[model samples]
Target: MQKIKSIFKTTGTKNGTYSVGLTVIVIAIVVVANLIFGQIPEKYKNIDVSSTKIYDITDTSKELLKNLDQKVTFTVLAEKAGADDRIKTFLSKYSSLSKNIKVEWIDPVLHPSALSEYDTSANTIVVACDDTGKSTTVSFSDIIVMDTSSYYYTGNATESEFDGEGQLTSAVNYVVSDSNKNIYRTTGHGEATLSSSVSELMTKNNYKVNELNLVMDTSIPEECDLLLMYAPSKDLTEDEKTAVEDYLAKGGKVMILLGETSSADLPNIASVMKEYGMETEDGYIADPSRCYQGNYYYIFPELSVSGDMAKGITSQMVLLTNAHGMNLVDPARDTITTSPFMTTSENAYAVTEEAQKQGAYTLGAVAEETISGDSAGKTDADTSENDGESDDAEQEEQKTGRLTVISAGSLIDSQITDTFTQLENTTLFMNAVSSNFDGVQNISIEAKSLGTEYNTVQHAGLFSLLVIFGIPLLILISGFTVWYRRRKA
Candidate 1:
């Protein structure tokens, strides 16, 4: 009996020692793992699990952060107690994207003299870059958008969206950019001016908008990066046309939005577009199958998603009214390539004054011409003796000119864009203008509507199967292994 009791005591001591050693190893492993993970950035570890993904930034923002060279700081002027939680969460995620970003939450009461020169009030955000000494201030109303559309009837202003990401990203982009792209709109022809919303969008994308009268100026300015002929009712003058032709010869960009007029009415303007293989028809397009309500003229055209114009445009539907049918003067050209980005279906037809024509038509198209060699503008006979010179000139003369033509003027109207909040008419126009600049990215992120249920994942077949079947199968295998080991023992 004494020997058996001693054996039991020895066994108990060994078991207790093994248990303590195992516990210590587990605790050490956990501590080391936590320390390793703590060193990583918060963006990689913290997943946005919110239903609306309020804290998650889009791929557009990610691309901007990847190319960020200068350090940008966002200074929020609000006390910690009174700060908006949505803004705080977004800024945290934004800062974690790059080491060049820093966010500071400064209360005006505590730091009375800090940033006194800026016109900042409570809840205003100042995004500044010390390298360039440039700063942009975002007001409280810009961050948190309010919808007063219903207030006129209900007498209560409701919250529309938290657009903190859009505002802050645009602000950062403005201060970091080297210079703005100068866009000169043609005036003195009864052309429509850009809407306030469109003008503001242009400003955010670092485009300086100014008016230019071709008759008065006689030539496109040297500083003009893009020329805008926005739905001009009258044709260009003889000298004006020559000036435009010269600008294009030396590599210039032009965006032409045609009004509801025939090619015969604007002969000089038509001639300029004809050089790029784009011409407009007499009347509007009528798509009976792709229109809204019973109105066949208010057609929803098909979008070529593979085109550059479709980049960064999420919402697909665009409303275009009083649009002319587009035709290519030369469908195939070795020097100029013309492709339509927006077209109508086969069943659609154009309604003209003469008669209705049944055929598929183009509503928007882009024409690009690459002029190379010394004989670019010379005739075949003139270049017959200069083959060697042309071969050498090919290396030096590689200039490209682009012309973007949209069929409708109403596409940029304020009533269409402001009324149809769900449609992407404004975004489409913005993307078209932004495609000219090589490195510029258009920021047209919409404000997330408050109190709306967004079902992001519509189809989760694989996820459903894993949750329903995979978990129970693992449990069964674990239970069977434990039972088998105990029974054998």
Candidate 2:
């Protein structure tokens, strides 16, 4: 009986100990599992609800909002179905960040009245404001990609998934900023228009471009900040001359893009340049090695970068201008300092008329100066010019730069879009222009935007959120339930 009693007690103690040990083991396993897998919902049996990263405050939209000061409205003129998810997502992200940006959806089909007033198209955005009274339209193609390589819609029948959020953000930047500067480009006598790809790029970078026949209007508009003379085939009227002089006297900025006009022919303009610093030569600049498409056009020549205008943009760019030239001067005026913005390599030569007619010649150059006559940095009137008739070819001491001067009448050819990358040029040029100003703030000009660009992934076919979070969740639930049932039993 004693032995039996002892045996029974031993067995009871062992059973109790075994049960406690098993329960402890189960609890440990549950705790370890929770630590490894994280939380999961029940319905998503195969889903993994775990996330490796947390939501942060600083995103691309937020960074963009922080840079903007003016109130901007992004009016979406399409159905939600047509809207690019990336654009909407970016706008939504921007909306949550700052009160300065507001998004409104307008179905152009439903309201035909808006189409006329806003000139809006399908899947488009009209960025506008009541104060500036200026509005810019962005089409679906304007902000999105046409193809994966070399962006152009394949005969207007193809579209690519474009995360245009990044670029459109930059566009909104151009319109809303105070630097939407206007460079009134002279036309008539046949100058180029903003319709060209290069001009389009100029406009995109805070320049409100307009073809001006100052001869027609007599007065250069008060709103215009600068004037540009680009390959004008005709001479300016006396009134036009006075208009130009008056603008310069008022401390306005001017850029002359000259062509194959003779020295005597450009007397009025040459006289103005001579007052500042230099004069355009009678013959064309020629280089055999640098000639393009043949001898009439210059080819890859080493360009001179000696001024702010040239140095600012040439950080990483190779220019390819054709038949364009200029008469640049570095005047003694305290308000001006002209320098060679571009030049061909030393292996280059400025061929006179004899060589030009011989079917070989150098054809382009660039020139610019810091014209600070007043507090706002303006160009002074051509007050003192000798108009020297010095035809000395001994310009070995003459300093020129990458401010390209193309002798060819058409440096910016119609096929400019095919030959050059306008997007790249525009970005750097805009940066240069923004930096050129005396007192203004440009965010990109100052520094990089922010932390890592938070590009949101597409919400698509069941793999993204489901696989990442759903599957882990199911195992967690099943494990917990089995533990619970075993405990109950």
Candidate 3:
């Protein structure tokens, strides 16, 4: 009986020893981890800093922060309600970019009168110089798009697709640099008025909006940084063409837009557009895939996108229209890269029908094309013209190369916007036009704030679902399995 009791006790002792050993191992691991990671900061606990990625910094934005001399302060006056992880994340990046870039998230809600320090709204940014701590304020919603074109897309202009190039760098330069923006809008030939919603967007950004009457004045204003040509009637006189060419030659930025009128309708203006490798057909575009199936007036469709200015805009377009449009095909060689930044469905095609019936394939349209007008310039003319068809007046038509040709009429005019919102295309076209000019870096950083859709990187709704829920559930399931196995063992 004594031997049996001793054996049982020894067996219990062995079990106890194994348990003690396992506990000791876990404790040792915890101690070592704490030592190596330096007792993880309280704020960063649970957030694996090892998994945090440092965005590849551009030389421009990099050199900016690196060479910064003063103790710079970032006063973010975001309303606490909409203040999000995105702003926080970017703030962290800004911190990483420069030690001088001090970021303070100010809550205007908590202390309503705190805005008096900067004498601005809560949505404004007060960027102070590191040297004297002197500051300048930019709006919280102030946007930037980096594409080199004169025009930048903001507020909800539509495009067919996306490009990953970090155009934000240019906007960063604009924000940090002392350079002021000079945005020019061209008027004549029944263009949309500047006081419209699109023009108001510029005003909100504190840009000086000037209406350019190149037809009347025959010269681009000296203070101009970007020139915009909204949908125009066939009215660019020869003097207007020469003035435009001269402005572009001197590296001045510009934007041009067209409506439904064709080369046939606006012979003088058509000559300019044709020079840019854009040719307008006589009619319109109609497609079941691109049009409202049951509704004859609703023309909702996906346009095409490419780097080609002739493509007009980008794949990021979402335009609403009652009638579709006409387009410009690159009538030039492959050296002219017509970036398919935007495109319609393959089922769509241009229609040559006139005075059409409801059932007939008919909608307004335009396909813009671009070509080299100079070593550093692009023109709209490349499509061949009928030699015998040239008239004395047609011979003097001003030619446009790297020019944006529009085949749609209603989309460009404001009166018809009642049925469609080419406002997206309008913004995009002007942006492209402003960008078409050579050498002037296009600033588009604020474009990131265009919406959460762009912020999501890729169909973010789906990716977010996976990250916010699926991944955590997977981990929980894995933990449960581990616990179950341990109990069984």
User: Which tens-of-lDDT digit does each residue in 1-489 have in candidate 2?
Assistant: 999778757978789879999999999999999876655422122322213111122243356677667878888888876776645654554455567777799887787677777765677778876556667777766555454443343444334333344345556666666555776788775665433445544544556676687767878887776576766666777778777765665556566656556656757666666665655555555556655567634454444433333433433444344433344545645555555444554454445656533332222333344322331222233322323424342232232111223333333444442345321233333333443344432222111121233557676666666877888898899999999999999
Q: Candidates ranked by TM-score, best first?
A: 1, 2, 3
Per-residue lDDT, model 3, residue 432, is 54
lDDT at position 324, candidate 3 = 33
Candidate 3 residue-wise lDDT, 404-483, digit = tens = 33334344445533233323555454445444444333232213223223233867898889999999999999999999
lDDT of 2 at 306: 34
Which candidate ranks first by lDDT, i.e. highest? 1
Give the C-alpha miss distance for residue 10 in model 3, angstroms: 19
* lDDT, model 3: 0.50
Give the CA lDDT, 0 to 100, for residue 95 in model 1: 85
Clashes of each: 0, 50, 86
lDDT of each: 0.80, 0.53, 0.50
Model 2 residue 156 lDDT? 47
- Tens-digit lDDT track for model 1 on 261-359? 666788988888778888776677998888879798998888885545676677678988988887788834567888788888777778877888877
| Model 3 TM-score on a 0 to 1 scale | 0.49
User: Whole-model lDDT, candidate 1?
Assistant: 0.80
